[model samples]
Target: MNARREGDAAVQSYRRAQQRLRDGGKDVSSEQRLIRIEDALDALLDGLVKQREQIGSGVAVDVAGHTLAARARSRR
Candidate 1:
């Protein structure tokens, strides 16, 4: 999937998980629940990392192109 899709899916899943936990009240303190929360958090982080990587790559490319153009103009 694309970066935005992946990011949106991650956010939705995290929100669902959080809601489930909130609804669980005092009965969802099992190890499984903790594991689920941890997994959700990890997925959220992974999505954020992917989005940031895509953004950073684009910014870097733009900056490099601008620098090259500036140098070429100076040489002319």
Candidate 2:
């Protein structure tokens, strides 16, 4: 799955977990779990933004040991 799709899934998971906690009443452990989920979501979103920016700017992007660029420059 793509980053965007993964991010969406993460959001849905977080919402479901949050709703469950709310229905069951909050506890220390559950709150901690929620915090961790939120942190993961934030990190995923941040990574997506960075990837989009890199792609838009035509910068070289490293993926699995290979570099991809929008337009290759000729060697001088």
Candidate 3:
């Protein structure tokens, strides 16, 4: 799958994990799932942050080439 598809899947996974935890998913398995998802999503956030920093430093580093930051320049 493409980056966008993977991002959407990550979001869905996060929501499901959050809901499960909020719904009293306190068992060991549920916590394990939550931790795994969080770790993955945290890495996703790190990548996005790095991209933002690159853009700020006058570097065009939008790997997928369709991010909001990539389009921000054209809309001006």
Estimate candidate 2's alpha-carbon lDDT, on a 0 to 1 scale: 0.53
Who is ahead in lDDT, 1 or 2?
1
Residue pairs in candidate 1 whose N, alpha carbon or C atoms collide under 3 angstroms: none
Per-residue lDDT of model 2, residues 1-76, tens digit only = 3555545655665565555444533455767767766766665666566556545444332453243232333332
User: For residues 32-71, what per-residue lDDT tens digits would candidate 3 score against the true structure?
Assistant: 8777667666756655654445454443334435577568
Instruction: Give the runs in model 2 whose Cα sits over 4 Å from its true position.
Output: 1-28, 59-76
Steric clashes per prediction? 0, 0, 0
TM-score-superior candidate, 1 or 2? 1
In model 1, how large is the Cα lDDT of residue 9?
A: 63
A best-first ranking of the candidates according to their lDDT comes to: 1, 3, 2
The lDDT for every candidate, in the order shown, is 0.67, 0.53, 0.55
Instruction: Give candidate 1's error at residue 74 in angstroms.
Output: 1.5
Query: Given candidate 1, what's the lDDT at residue 36?
Result: 71
Worst 10 residues of 3 by lDDT: 55-64
Poorly placed runs, candidate 3 (over 4 Å): 1-28, 59-76
